[model samples]
Target: MKIDWVIVGAGFAGATLAERIATHLDKKVLVVEKRDHIGGNAYDEYDESGILVHRYGPHIFHTNLKHVWDYLSRFTRWRPYYHRVLAVVDGKKVPVPFNLNSLYALFPPGQAARLEEALIDEYGFGARVPILKLRESEKKDLRFLADYIYEKIFYGYTLKQWGLKPEELDPSVTGRVPVYISRDDRYFQDKYQAIPEHGYNQLFRRMLAHPNINVLLNTDYREIENEVKFSRMVYTGPIDAFFDYVYGKLPYRSLRFEFATLDREWFQDVGTVNYPNEFDFTRITEFKHLTGQEYSGTSIMREYPYADGDPYYPIPCPENEALYKQYRLLAEKESNITFVGRLAQYRYYNMDQVVDVALKTAEEILRGI
Candidate 1:
């Protein structure tokens, strides 16, 4: 039962690290995932109508890091892609990122230009007087901004995602949201953007193809038959569960989705459209927009947030963080285990940050090994 390392969860955090450590460091690792799949939430495969759908939810790979992009390139060639978003407000659909195109599309042409000038004058972006950093004026405040974003783009969607009004959640939760001045509607502005040409599952399959990495799907980490054989264990599962919930389970928000196959060729021209004014669901994502697969049919998903489930988004409130601290302190006392990834760290991180953290954590662990 001897092994060099026991890595838990086969998601990007563990799978990417396993590839690096086993290939370069020549470490014999046992990779165990609580779920039945290797790709975790990023897993995608062809659906009934030949649409490559995101099984858990929609995820776009966008990162500013070149090393990560290069490292993953070893696994699969990327399909050149750019992600965009739209909002449905007052029966009008427009681009997200709040750009000029969306402005002109939303308002009458002349009024749109006037509003643009006024907004730019008030809130200069990337300039000496950046609106985001400036002190609030008598006219500008939390209430004003929240109301504006909520009414036009975020309120209904936020309500759909959190099951609460935008006012109920901390502004910090929504603070990272922006009011962009440029006409660029691309949801993310990154150098390299793509879905794996084959698929995410294939990339992960190649990532864990090394002889030294043994991946066990359909087996939860808790069900590992072997006992204390490895020198160290990296547990990427939920931290509260790792400690057996001694600190009362840390809060996490999850989503439930209803996917459908439309008889039409397309649902929307854009990939995603946020229902800022309609539907209990936050947004509808058309798989056709994401995958670029050609077919007479299409697939769409309506995302509904739930208070309980597999713990997607960690609750951002300080009380939840304080509780996570107790579990972390207990994890610190464990001599042979390391916690990693979103659930383990109890933070909301994008795909790149998780991959970067996994790479860094693997580097630290290699020194120890």
Candidate 2:
């Protein structure tokens, strides 16, 4: 069998490129996926209780890029949503980002007021100050506030999620762990925040529903690469695995999710609650809040980070980046292959970013053709 393009994986990266190539370029493209289904980690479906749940933990779509949002808007209608996360600190559930409201939630009125004034004076009202950067403050009050947030909110959570302290990871990651100076409890401050109207699965199905695109699920690309003829390849799987771990393997942190269907209508006040200082799991996400599905019962997922599992998060450290750089240099030499997405690039990316990358990759492919 012959095809214009052979794309590996049926996730956003692969699906977007396949759709673009098939629709714009009018070329036959085959998408081979190891999983039986599509949408990659963003896949969602109604649980046994009829509540929509993300198969791979909670994925809240929030992005500042208008082009990314506009592109996806073509496939599925949007459900306006703003994601909020709370953490168990001193037996109280406060906002996860440790914002001004979180400060008031944990501290006494007078002390909270004092600290709030100090924080705003130091970093302004809406400024986001990284915990590590805040820790560098010469002011005693700001220093104390930074230490408090780091210990209560970030320390245990980071330890559980990444198996390393905030300081041990790359500064790019640690720098993202910020303490918002505002009273906003929303996790992301992006310009647009929403979920697909039906679900991520529906969005993916519509995205890959072009006449020139063919999805072959439950099959690895390598098994049929020899039998099929294609001019170019677009790979969205792990970069290390594609190269067969020639330069050893890049480290990754995996997750174990435990989903429970409760008899109650709602589990928590918000979409997600983090058990930072206690429990083996990092957080519990209530799916109803995310999907806006009105149901009799609630379905929640508990995420536990571990070493041995499917690669979920690429560990952000100098050694891992160095290893990925070596693989990237090798990938750059392959002129016919276009590598995109989280696993292929070995970098953490938001859902919108993945789509943006695939769109740009498709444009590059079309330009060359």
Residue 209 error, candidate 1, Å: 0.5
Query: What lDDT tens digits, residue by residue, belong to model 2 across residues 257-306?
Result: 99999999988999999998899999999999998888888999999999
Candidate 1, residue 279: how far the Cα is off, in Å: 1.5
Q: Which stretches of candidate 2 lie above 4 Å from their native place?
A: none
Q: Which candidate leads in lDDT?
A: 2
TM-score for all predictions? 0.92, 0.98
Candidate 2 lDDT at 218 equals 94
Residue 225 in model 1: lDDT: 47
